[model samples]
Target chain A: MARTEIKIGGFGGQGVILSGYIIGRAAAIYDSKHATMIQAFGPEARGSACSAQIVVSAEPIAYPYITTPQIMIVMSQEAYTKFSPELAEGGILITEEELVKTHNLRKDLKHFSIPATRFAEELGRKMVLNIVMMGFMTSVTGIVGVEAMRQAVKVSVPKGTEHLNLNAFNKGFEYGEKLKSGAA
Target chain B: MKADPKGVVAGAYFIDGDHACAEGAIAAGCRFVAGYPITPSTEIVERIAERFPLIGGMFIQMEDEIASSIAIQGAVWGGKKAMTVTSGPGFSLMMEHIGLAAMTETPCVFVDVQRGGPSTGLPTLPGQGDMMQARWGSHGDYGIIALCPNSPQESFDLTIKAFNLAEQYRVPVLVMLDECVGHMTERVVVPPADEIEITPRRYWDGPKEGFLLFKAGPDRVPPMVKAGDGYNIHVTSLTHDERGYPVMTAAAQEKLVRRLIDKIRLNSDAIVECREEQTAGADVVIVSYGITSRIAIPAIEQARREGVKVGHLRLITAWPFPAKRIRELSHHVSCFVVPEINYGQMVREVERCVAGRTRVERVSHGGGAVHNPKDIYAKIMSCGKEERK
Candidate 1:
């Protein structure tokens, strides 16, 4: 069976992990696929670069960690610096446009950018930036269905705040759709 | 019997292996847990600590590993199912108590979420280096039961199995989990409480007048009893008679130790469980446990893609080492490829069981990250080119 390896990277407390978690829940719980998520753990504090590796497969997962990711979604400059080069040729690269700047970009891959941090601020919850990224990634990459991603975000966010997170997700998803249609 | 419906959270979860183990322990009716928080394994006790209070269970964060290890034994003797969670350094400290549990026939589980280690090597990385330690580090010739779980689901299932085995054999069962499996998040489907079968504690119900604490029943497993229920129980770590008194004689040692080992050895056919895939007619059979078994899949498939017949034997039970199956496979396969996180721990067991009947190829590393599948693929390819049996 085919396995798609994805990496989500950012500093601590950015919900980078929850972003990966939502995708896994979407794939494994909602989409009926096998999803495994492994996050980097070390003596890490806030603002330190960290990453989560996710593998979604049609069959049982083998060799769990992401050796070379086919999808790289980075939200921090440090994460972009450390993980972008590891993306395989012809992979999809999604970035939080307001937080990460592109340089020494690979030519063989399709790159999409979204102002996730700005979208979250517009939604009045800066912490939901990861959800915004998740929405944008779902629309741009189509790795998971939009409905499954929405269900995952709804169930994963804190109680009584699902509406706001969904708004943040909708903002990023709309922007991604615009980018796909060359309207933005 | 079915599990207590109060503790079973019947639903699907996206959780790590450690958390799944905690849930499994609860679903299996574990009521007391004493542990010292260690990385990779701490989440187990943390989850247990949170859930225990609601279910009338108790969780103690003991001062150190030594205290944590022995505390569970105390809880077991108090008529409750108990367990202790630890990693490498803590596992080392719990060795003496493991011997204590074996000598006293304490039914409890010890969970070692192994990390890269000799000391405090890689606190958060994965390793299967402690496989041998789980079997032999406790000292003495008493038989032990250890289980290796590959993923979050197995971590849940095997923890319940570990507790049941511990109760049946009245021995300390080790749930050996590597950091990768313990920390990796995956989908775990928990069935309803009524669907989960549990092995209730084998309690002594015979006349309490002339109770001999250590006397073996027909199954070679002595039934357990509560201490304050008018039954005088003397449990110890020394070589003791059926009366639970230390008898420093060699004959006493022979009887006590022999029964301890025989209880597990004789019942090994029932205790040992292994999952074999595609070993019917293959050139190489990969013997692995814990995360290494899952990591070998791509290598197995890669070798197959290159026209190599590679079979895989994933050890669901590590201790009592599945010798009969390996001996049978030895005559049928050309070689056994063992890929483990340690330099070579379980490979020795495979060799001992194979007895030179087949080529035993080892793919090994120290501890830390998992083996590169390409490296394992290369080993399988090399072994695949050999003559078939």
Candidate 2:
């Protein structure tokens, strides 16, 4: 079975785990693939340097955690520094552009940056930054379909915040489409 | 029996194993739960506490693990399908009650989401160290049923199975989950209530006068009569006769204890469930359970690609240990490799069942994390080279 290992790293309350959950639900529920997500535990999850490990596969996944992630998303500098070295060769690295400064990136790897926090703020709620990043990740990697992610976001978010979250997702997706077209 | 339609939350959701287990208990008609919350296991009771109130069930946060363990038993005799949830440390505290449940033939569920431990070790990490304890933790020789679940889905499904087995055999059934599977989030599809099977408790419906509390039924499982049923019955830990009276004689002890043990030992074929793959003409077989079974898959696949004939025997029911099947596979397989979170626990059983007919090796760990598939693959490579008969 083909498997994709994805890791999302950020401090707690940044919705790092929730972002992982949305992607996992999108793939497993909407895209009809098997998805498993494991959140970092203990004190690390309380406030600092938390992470979520995800695996999406065509078949039932075994050996749940990622050894070297094929896709790494980082929202904080600590996470980027801690996890960037373990990214697989030619892996895609997505980052929160305003929160982290990228330097000495591996030449073989592809780097994609999004001002997710800014996008969320534009939507009048900063907590939706994780959703913004998810939209960006979907457009950049095409890991999950646009319609599937929209459906996952609706079911996953709080009842009243669906409209705002969808707008945040579309803003991020629009920017990603510009980047893909070499216009940004 | 079909599950009560009201209890089932029919939907597909992304949830963790602990939450799924709570849903499973709710679906299985468990109306009473007592637990002193502990890490990796607390989420189970947390969900129960939130859901129980609205469902006409009871969730009690007892003073300690000891209280939590016995409270479920008290509720069981009161005629509620009941359960207690705990981790390794709390599980140790509940050991005495587990034995008591077995002796009294109390049908109840005990969930142990295992963590690393000699004593409260790795409170938030995964370990299968309690595998032996679940089987032989309590003092004295008695039989119990234990099921180990590998994923969030199994955690949900096996919990219902645990309650069913507990009712079917009138024994205490343990749902053994490690920290990894307990906390990992996955797509868990909880089916419609009518689609789910429920095992109704074997309650006596006979005339209350002169009713025997411990009389063996056709399958050797005694029917339970709820407390205050007008039948004066005695349930005790001491050796007792069918009348449920304390019979201190050696003959009484023999009769009571043997039935307790043989109820499981003789009816093992019905209680045992293992997932076997590729055993035919294989040189080596991998025996594992819980999260360890899933971790061994990649290594098994790697070995198969390298032209090694390897099979997997995953224990869904860890106790009433799948001895007969292991013995049958032992005749053809050249060797066995066991990898678990603990240094060596269930591997001993694998060795015993193989009976020197084939060599056995252990890829052991101390329980902070899962086995690196490469290390398991290394062991499989060496075991595959054993001289086959």
Candidate 3:
């Protein structure tokens, strides 16, 4: 199956929801891939951990929710603790180094420690942590192109918020570039 | 034996019950579907969305069940057959709009693919906990048409019938399939569109002069023209007369309310449906519907092969209670076995219909597990065997 499972987890209202939806839409609309976005949230929209799974495939998708995830995106320390065990062995784990202090990280899994929250704050948008991570995901995994991600955000974000979300997205893309230069 | 054309298309193909319901809605000529995703019913929304776009129909995922219900009412007012599907929790959320649909006499179909409940008890599991709720969920004395399908094919067939009845009576109808029937994968035969009989909303072609929205001319159902159509079709939740204008007077409420309930009550004989096996001279009669009926049929057949005079009553239409058939079956049978997925919900109705004339017993299971036919057979043989006395 060409379908790939990507999971995003964080406390509710952290924009993990927007990130997952954008990813799913990007795959479906821009890349001609079938996509399914499944979300689980606690009763409280804020302060409670939330998780969303996005499956993008070239084939017609069956079973919208993914049973196993190939990539894990954790935005908070609690999110990392909650979803760390469920990540597929040898899968990639990307998280903000500022918020998630201690992680029960495994040896085989590759972890990317990016200052997504700091980047969002630097860009004057505290809620763009998910957007930054979305950028890092597309850059690192090449699962979705940055242009497709930007187009996805443009189409999905509500009427007035498009320009600000796109700016946050570009800031995230720049952050990924910095990480790539440091590695080089 | 030469096969009839209608029966020729009733063969089986592999499909899930939820998928069959979506297909059934389309076959019923449903042009609009509005729903929010809830387990056991999410497949219905997904399937509808996938197909509706291609068929030039509208499929919307509203903010909540309440909004979904309202959106469907709007679409139906736009002159399209509309439907919504949800599970127990979502169905609970939809009761308010259901009451609205009743008061306004809006024609639509609501499918409640039941699951374990009381509050998100189990998302992926099966349950028949919503039987009572389906009948009396909305707050008020009102009537509704509900059908319970035992298999995937019935899910499709009954969904079509639900829309037909809704349009025919200008009332809301429900397809109450439980999680077992909703989620179970089985073979289903999908007939071409031309093979199925579809009923659209009856619209009055007469001029706008002297148009009373609530008034029934020759037939009890008033012709409903679409919103943008020149006719002034005013419908509301308030008490209204044939003119469709709200009136505080008790006289107007009396006439309108009576017609709302009487429409179904008067025509229940034609609406009631059931399947029977060896009902004549049988000592034991097992009564069931939906997934429970699925098990009861085999158990009754097994008992018959074993030389026991056990008969089956599989109820396809649960609402209106199929009271006449149950009463007739009760007269001939000594014992009644009610196998249900709920804890004695439908059994109560069976008891009431049977009264003290027949000994009515319940074979019940809930919280997502189905009752085994062996258990029902054992219960029947123990209580219903003629030689036991």
Candidate 4:
């Protein structure tokens, strides 16, 4: 892509920033592209609608803020309601199935939903939900390669839990592949 | 000297400017850091707190910005490279100590990840409003070095340069990072230990029996001796002589203060740095620093595409104001456009240097966000048209 703008939004504890970081790192470090990630800062980010914006480009990203995000991964109802309307025409919308309600979405957008938290719970750690979502994002959008995201996730997660996170990512990736093949 | 291997994290990784700055401090051999965490700048201290222990360094979370500012000075006197990080409000709280550091001629770094503010404004947004305050906030005729990095990679590289400048000049150096540059994340490649060069403190190896503590040699910088190093030293904020005693006379003030100002003023040729592009034959130039410089690139390109003959001058070191270069360009260029997040801080400097030789246009923003490139391009186009007329 010439330039791809991605916005990830959720509450504070959902690792919204980390998911953006993983995606940005995958593109910038592993895939040899330029990526700039900026997170929502200050007091309001604690328990409210926090977000992270990532810009992936073939060249250096001069403008940091996203005007019209080409992709939005919302993990909360508030985030969905607030940010979904701002998605560009013919953009991609990825959301957590159990958390966000799809309503009044743009018809031109390519929408994908996954129960990332439930998948993480099935993998025995609810904290890895962001990683699962990241895996799904990688597979669904193909913004970054699968192996590159896996490498980024390995180095990014907390020590001693890389195995669990990788498993969660694999589960989400498998689900995304199944959905893409129209078997879900 | 090459960086110490223990402090160097040699690899390619994606990290924010704040974390990259923390790594630069470690790589620059910063052994002690004292800070009170604040928004937009907390990540710097947090990263330092996490990595300092492993590098055999110390990180102290002080009660507040006041204590945090002075605590780093004490660490410097105790024979350690020290620093403190903060945002606008904390930076305001630190002005007094900054004066003290200037007076005492301490070698330390102060990382001000600036946010929008006169008083506690916009903690989450970016601002370049502190440019003037960094130079004159401390109410004195003393000199300090301040650098503004435009990207995360420069944030890592210039941070080390900040420490080196502090050591070389024996004065506190400021790393003036706005919120945008501080929080913006990107790929940073930290070189191996052998690739980095460090400037060690110029310690006095002469006899302590007849030492003049505040005396300067040919370099206009006094050699330092650590406390508890068996040397009698007196460090105070008052005007003193070479012996470090309060002279309290006009002569004493001139002798002490003149050297303090001259140290950086005379050596500004070595201290000041900037990046210039297409200035060899251009009609208009855009002068900018910090995040504004990055945003100005596309505007410059756009103006060039419209055949405006535009050049770019990016300020890597904002202090000692690259006046000589600007003055030289003033003679040839028809106009100089300055775009900053502030309403007009550095624009005044450009006007002063131009001295009515050329039109100086200010593309000012009031700090919440960066400038729209189209706005800057419009200014450039107008300037170019004016020049053509």
Best by DockQ: 1
lDDT of each: 0.91, 0.92, 0.79, 0.92
Per-residue lDDT of model 3, residues B238-317, tens digit only: 88878778899878877887787788888889888988877788888888888787667556767778878887888888
Q: In model 3, how many backbone clashes occur?
A: 2
Worst 10 residues of 3 chain B by lDDT: B1-10
DockQ of each: 0.91, 0.89, 0.02, 0.78
lDDT for B382 in candidate 4 is 92
Clashing pairs in 1: none
Lowest summed lDDT window (length 10), candidate 2 chain B: B380-389
Worst 10 residues of 4 chain B by lDDT: B380-389
TM-score of chain B of 4: 0.99
Question: Which docking band does candidate 2 fall into?
Answer: high
Clashes of each: 0, 0, 2, 0
lDDT of 1 at B123: 93
Reference-based TM-score of each model = 0.98, 0.98, 0.66, 0.96
Badly placed stretches (over 4 Å) of model 3 are: A1-184, B1-13
Q: Each model: TM-score of chain B? A: 0.98, 0.99, 0.94, 0.99
Give the chain A TM-score for each candidate: 0.96, 0.97, 0.90, 0.98
- Supply the TM-score for candidate 2: 0.98
